[model samples]
Target: METRTVVAECIGTAMLVLFGVGSLVLAGDYINALGISLAFGFTLIAIAYAFGRISGCHINPAITLGVLLAKRIDIRRAATYWVAQLVGGIIGAAILFLLAKQVPRLQTAGAFGTNGYGGRSPVGLGAGGAFLAEVLLTFLLVFVFLTVTQKVALVGVEPIPVGLAYTAVNLIGIPLTWASVNPARSLGPALFAGGGALSQLWLFLVAPMVGGVLAAVVHRFTHQRPVGQAQQEQAAEPPRVGPWGRMRGGHRPEAGGPEAKGPEAA
Candidate 1:
């Protein structure tokens, strides 16, 4: 079960980087901000459906870190996920580079689409601006993820809520910080872009992870453990009563029992 979840996280993260960063390498400014956002949002949408059952479809390191800090997942599992996410990001970057090699006169576009601040920013925003944007955006993203994935009375298979939430987040954030709610999304790009991107990588990773942790902490205050964990605890506890409770000398009656003429017989 744990293996499946980890696998899903790795695969989903890879898919996200492949599409989102892939677009950056294939189409420079032509892909535009909105298109890039859609690539990310759509990848999340697709992953939600594909891996939701296995790992709740969390492919972002910031998200995983946030949830872990919130105490949703144990340390061991969270560490495994973080490792998977990093490896997956590197792989996705390599793949994007490979695909970029096929294009003509597209050298500049062949980056991993890494997120950066200052001069590397789409709008040339500084580190402070980028940090704030990442913090706010990722906070919203994680909060929405917690709510949408919640199993309410009428709400089941929470993929749509999460997917739509991501799309909406992207719509508002694409113009700013290129909407990197997920750190790994920004990381793949930096690996290829280097220089400015490499220098400013800290903000992209730190801000989003911070935002995620904040959201997760808030989530914990409002709710108990996840349904799955609760169920596991319940299952682990011993049953209250045993077969003896239901056997021969049980409560009042015996197999050949007669009223024995209660007080009236006396």
Candidate 2:
């Protein structure tokens, strides 16, 4: 509930949509899909390093949901982050829309970098294909995020893998559904684009959330619990007595023993 954290999330999400979607809205003709994809990836890397300490730089509602489901953050914090991120995204898109309007002959009404399928899709992918593509693409991003941010992961280098995973998903997803792995990112531009973008918005929102949930479920099965969490869980359990009356299950290692030293002892 820290005010600064919420502000950071809002500012971070705004920067993401501004730079990532702005690259497309303003410079898609020059930079093309690869450049746009890199824009999104690089923006994420910068946000992660800059605000990762304060807010973890979720920026994306789907990512926040994944973190929440993983129990990394409580519901109150997650809801706060979601609101901040959505507001930030809309603010960013609004800024982009104004900038685009300044450019001569630039169109911001129909597309405006909004995600879509069917005719709006680069490859004309159908609704079902787009939904599946978004789910799988978002799954990869969320899964990488969950795995790389773990206690076992190398500190100070999580952004590299996460950004790279984002770039990879975008590379494959752009032609299909414009790579809407983040619902906040998609909703922002769609609000401005209106028309078909509004109608098709449901798929982008629902698919990413489903993917986040799946990522959390799979992450639980794949990664071991942090040592401190395991210890806490053990401490909370009632102690049991064996046949000989020795403490079992919830017993803690004797003080100064090797077992009592935890992972640091290794």
- TM-score per candidate: 0.76, 0.84
lDDT of 1: 0.71
Q: Which ten residues in a row have the lowest lDDT in candidate 1?
A: 246-255
| Candidate 1 ranges beyond 4 A from true positions | 28-31, 108-111, 151-156, 222-266
lDDT scores in order? 0.71, 0.88
The most accurate candidate by lDDT is: 2
lDDT of 2 by residue, 1-266 (tens): 67988998999998999999999899999999899999999999988888888888888888889899888889999999999999999999999888899999998888999999999999999999999999999999999999989631223989889999999998898888889999889999999999999999999989999999989889988895765998898889865655444445533334322233468644
lDDT of 1 by residue, 48-141 (tens): 7787777777788777776676666788877888888877777787777777778776664323566666666668887788888888888888
lDDT of 2 at 196: 96
Write out the backbone clash pairs for model 2.
none
